[model samples]
Target: MAKSRFRSTTEHTMDSKGRLNFPSRFREVLNQYDSEILMVAPWGKNHLRAFPLPEWEILEDRLMTEGREKPDLANFIRYVVGGVAECSLDKQGRVQLPVQLRTKVSLAKNIMLVGMIRHVEIWDKEIWQQDNEATSENFDSFNEQLSQMGIF
Candidate 1:
């Protein structure tokens, strides 16, 4: 059986308490895992990535085993692994974004939850807009790259 993947995007506002509704579509995908928790962590300077517990474990295992002696990999493990937060979905279908994680990613009121196949990305709305625009402008080049990679 094929693994369920996240898809599409949704715009939402983080409440004053730092809680945002987890998109139902994303929840549907998560449901297949039989897990209620997400391993939320910083994806970059401006966004966060959330993985289901099982997926996070797979990644964590690889990070621990494959690059234990590499300095660059150690730094990555420090930043990404150290910053992970286990966020549980509340009954209201909202997940509380930890303050430190939010600050690390520069997230605030306006947010964008983007489906990234294996994981979900939570982006600051403004940053996502600028990045999306740049990607749109460079689509032809990106399309060629994708085609070269046999994606199309």
Candidate 2:
């Protein structure tokens, strides 16, 4: 497994043609995995997430395994896997966000690419701010859960 963790946020603009410049470092990680293919999927109605093909496969495996006996997981897995678009970047370090996905997440021309360890999350600036507004207030509550999980 690659030990490097993606840990930065960058703001970028989408060209008129609908292509956005992917960060060089992020692209390099995809290359290291031997694939540039990304499984783009919407989470909820506000944001979209991306996982390089190999990384996505690992997540798929875990979801599927848990889904075998858990109907809820199966249904969610169905939704996630069903609503994905396989994407690849062009030579210019730009990727065309599929219209369907763009609409799903309300992706505007100006957005932020956030690194979430294993995957990438593309967020509409307004939504990102909205979603995080309560994070600071809820940190202790959230931290308690993380501690229970042995994550902190």
- Estimate every model's Cα lDDT from 0 to 1: 0.92, 0.83
* Model 2 pairs in collision: none
All candidates' TM-scores? 0.94, 0.89
lDDT of 1 at 53: 97
Looking at candidate 1, the ten consecutive residues that score lowest on lDDT are: 66-75
lDDT score, residue 104, model 2?
Answer: 80
Q: How many Å off is the CA of 124 in candidate 2?
A: 0.6
Candidate 1 local lDDT, 27-139, one digit each (tens):
98899999989999987698999999999999998887887766688878888999999999999999999999999989989999999998999999999999999989988
Top-scoring candidate (lDDT): 1
Per-residue lDDT of model 2, residues 44-104, tens digit only: 7888888988888998888768668777676677667888889898998877888888888
